[model samples]
Target: MLGYIARRLGAGIVLALLVTFITFALLSTSFHDVALTILGPAATPDVTADLIASRGWDRPLLVQYGDWLIHALQGDFGESVYTSLPVAASVLQRLVVTLSIIVPALLLTVVISTFLGVWSASRGGIVDRIAQGISLIGYVVPGLLLAIGLVVVLAVQLKWLPATGYTPFTEDPAAWARSITIPVIVLTIGGVANLAAQVRGRMIDELRRDYVRTLRTRGVSTGAIVIRHALRNAGGPALTVLSLEFIQMLGGALIIENVFALPGYGSFAFNASLQGDIPVIMGIAAFGVLLVTVVNLLTDLANGWLNPKARVH
Candidate 1:
């Protein structure tokens, strides 16, 4: 298991490097004047050139990329060309906000989806049909739309919670929950649907397996057969879908964040891109790539643990 973990970690690092290089190349090539864009067009050409040169924008692309890579490896992450704030500091602050919301949403999604999925799979009647319909609605709704509807109903119409902005949990626990609850629900909708579908499919497959039948024939209680026998086998593929959904949620929260005005990494990246902040944009891309790679590695380790046969292969 240790060896497997090490190998996956190594592979994740390689993938991160590749992602960094590609992001750097694309941003550098596409943007002709990063500093000028940040400075605005009204500035004199001489001033713009001087500003650009001061930031090493006059350097060769490869040289710039190399320097950026060094800074990134050293945890510097450079400064935002637009705001002049350290990229690492900004990202870290926003990450805290994002994680506070995302973590609870993830946990809720897993628990709710797993229960509904297992129950639906085992029953397969009107209850199963109702669960499927709900899942379909969740899966089809766009995140931004869901967030808007939630804000309208819960914040505007009902006046039960704040519509936007984050408060630290330390400052006021109730306000913190109020600020994030809607956004968390919006973000988890698709994840819950996807995970429920995957879990249901896997559970059905497991229920049909010979081992499950053998356990049933041995006079084991249905609950014991499901909890001890089927659930373990169903977990392997369900875990894969769950991990992928998590990574997708991490990378794809930009629209929801914008709609809700939450100050998260997604919002930061979106603003950076709009302002043509090349360094900040590249930094966000690098962080996203690293996150996805790490999630994938963890998924592999989880799969191996759940099914020892996978480890052998």
Candidate 2:
């Protein structure tokens, strides 16, 4: 197990470095005038040149990336080109807000999707059809439209939750929950739509295998046979789907955050991009890669536990 974990961790670190390098190269090379973008049109030539030289934007891309990476390794991600605040601090602060919504929604997605999948697979008639229909609707709908519609009905009509705003969890727990309720619901629906189908399909395949029959013939109860044997076997593929779902939700969060006026990592990144703030953009890129790496690592560990064959590879 230790060996397996070390391998996965090493792979994740390598992937992180590779992704950051690519992102840094693209961001660095894509712009003709980084200083002008940040400093604006009215700035004099000397000011632009000074900004360029001071930030080492005048240096080769490789040298700049190397310097950035070295600082990043020591926990310095530079400062926002506009606000001048530390990039890491801004990213981490917004990350907490994003996670507050994402974490709960994902937990709910897992529980609800797993149950619906397992139950539908085991009872293969009306139950299966209903579950499939709901998932299909969810899968077909765009998250942006869903979020807007939800805000209209839930917040505008019902006045049950706020229309578009975020409250800090530390400020008021109840308001915080209310603030995130619609966004979380939007994300959860999309997540369950994809993951439940994967779970159901995998569960159905596992249930049909000969091992399942063997377990049943051995006088094991139906629930025990399904939960202890079939679910475990099916979980490997389902876990893969779940991890991909998480990454998808993070990407989709940009739309959701804008619709709901939430101050999250997505919003932060979006504003930074609009301003062409290279430092903030690079910081966001690095953090995103790290997050993906961590998620993939967790999925690998879960898969290894569920299927020892995974560890062998």
Candidate 3:
């Protein structure tokens, strides 16, 4: 198990490096005057040239990429060309805020979806059908549209929550929850729906297996059979889907963040791209790549633990 984990970690590191190189190459080739874009038209030509020179854009692409990698390894994400602040610091501050929102939202999603999926699967009638229908709607609706709709109904018309903006938890925990509640609801809807569907499908399959039939033949209690026997077997696939969705949520929160006016890595990356802050953009991309690689590696390890026979080869 340790060897397998070590190999997966090594592979994840290699994949992250590849992602960094690709992002660096693309940004270098596509944006010749990244510093100029950040400085705007008011800056003098000489000042812009000096900014470019300082960023070492005139150097060969490989040299620039190497410098960026070295700085990144040292926890120096480079200074934002637009704000003149360290990119790592700016991103980290925002990341904490984003995680505060996402973590609770993810937990809520897992609890709600797991219960709904199990309850629906246990019943084989209209309740199941309705649950399926709700899941479909949640899956089909785009996150941005759902966020806007939530703001309109819950924040504007009903005045139940803040429309958009973040309040620090230190200031007022209640207010922070109130401000982000709607966005969290919007963000979790899709994840819950997807997880519910996956869970329900797995449960259904597990219930039909020969072991379940044998349990039924032995007159095993339905609750015990479902909870202990079936659900445990179903957990492997459900966990896989959940982990993938959680990772996707980190990247996919951009549109929802914009709609809710939350300052997060997604918003930061978006603005950086629009302003051509190549260093910041690349840093964000690298961070995302690292997150995804780590998540996938963990997922693989989890699957191995859940079904050791499958990993025996």
Steric overlap count per candidate: 0, 0, 0
Per-candidate TM equals: 0.93, 0.95, 0.91
**True-vs-predicted CA distance for residue 130, candidate 3, Å:** 2.1
Give a tens-digit lDDT track for model 1, residues 222-272: 888877768778888988888887877777767767777889988888888
Model 3: weakest 10-residue lDDT segment is: 304-313
Question: Using lDDT as the measure, which candidate wins?
Answer: 2
lDDT of 2: 0.88
Kindly state the number of residue pairs that clash in model 1. 0
CA lDDT of every candidate: 0.82, 0.88, 0.82
lDDT of 3 at 182: 85
Candidate 2: tens digits of C-alpha lDDT, residues 1-313? 7876788789888888898889888887645466787777788999988987887877988898899999999999999988999999999998888888899989989998998899899998999999888878787898888888988999999999999999998999999999999999998998889888988999999899998899888998999988988899999999998888889888877888888888999999999988888888988988998999899988988888988888845
Model 3 CA RMSD to the hidden true structure, in angstroms: 2.3
Which parts of model 2 are misplaced by more than 4 Å?
A: 30-32
Query: Which 10 consecutive residues of model 1 have the lowest summed lDDT?
Result: 29-38
Clashing pairs in 2: none
Assess the local accuracy of residue 114 in candidate 1 as a C-alpha lDDT between 0 and 100: 86
Give lDDT tens digits, candidate 3, residues 1-313.
Answer: 7777788889888988898898888888755466566677688888877877876887898998888899899998888876889887888777777777777878888888888788788886998998888778787898878888888999899999999899988999999989889878876788888898988988889888999889999999889988898887787888788888877788777876788888987888888888888768877877777777777777777777677664633
A best-first ranking of the candidates according to their lDDT comes to 2, 1, 3
lDDT of 3 at 30: 53
